[model samples]
Target: MTKALKASGFLGLAVMMAVGLHQFVILSGGSAVPPWMIGGHAHLGVLSILAIVMGFAVPALGVVGQLRTAVTGLFIAGQWGIPGIVWLGEGFGLTFLMPTGFLWGGALIASMLIMLYKTVTTEEAGGGGRAGVAPADD
Candidate 1:
């Protein structure tokens, strides 16, 4: 799962870079930036970073098995879905796709909240020890 997250993060970064270059080209030609491009670039860049960071943080949260799998899946889906939908909708003037993009954002938020809840409720969260951290030898 960690490797998968990392790979997705890198792929997202690549896509974000491409979008950025496209934005630059448009601006250089005296064309205004499209709303969809702006939104997609921002979401893609931020979510890509989150995915990379979460690759390490998720494992450290002590979540495992099916729960972890579900969380990771949500993260990946949201990461791509939000921006992809936006580009398809706004770029093509298909406003109906906006709701689906919001749904993806909601899924991403839900995954983050779940991880946060697990972290805060754990013994290691209080600084005791866990998630591969060695306890004091005392």
Candidate 2:
């Protein structure tokens, strides 16, 4: 609900999108080369996970209940959606992606992005949100 949280959520969502696209490409017989960069998929996964954790932390500042609910909802959807996607992909002659890695990755990112944006924009009586400092505070 704060700017910082909103930013985190967006960043996380970006990560998720990247990972999902990567998986899709690989499954489509594109190339792991694209996904395998520096830390590679593994790294992306870890960073993305961190983003989610950090995003969750933002709610602690205020409106955490909403974030918790969002995350919980994402979790529930992931539980079924991910596996279902994988199954469908496999059925379509796809391998590599055994499960809906994209869904999980996307959800993580989406959750973080939401928090990050909220954290960055919301104003407070005092102190800066995620957008650095307010002129008044300075």
Best by TM-score: 1
User: Could you tally the backbone clashes for each prediction?
Assistant: 0, 27
- Per-residue CA lDDT of candidate 1, range 73-99, in tens? 999999999998889888888888888
Deviation of model 1 at 86, angstroms: 1.2
RMSD list, candidates in order: 4.9, 9.9
lDDT of 2 at 114: 69
Which runs in model 2 stand beyond 4 Å of their true positions? 1-41, 44-56, 72-99, 128-138
Question: What is the lDDT for 31 in model 1?
Answer: 94
- The digit string of per-residue lDDT tens for model 2 on 1-138 reads 344434544555565567677677776895554322323334444454554555556555454576656754564344334544444444445666545578676885676576667668666546545566456764
Instruction: Give the Å error, residue 129, model 2.
Output: 12
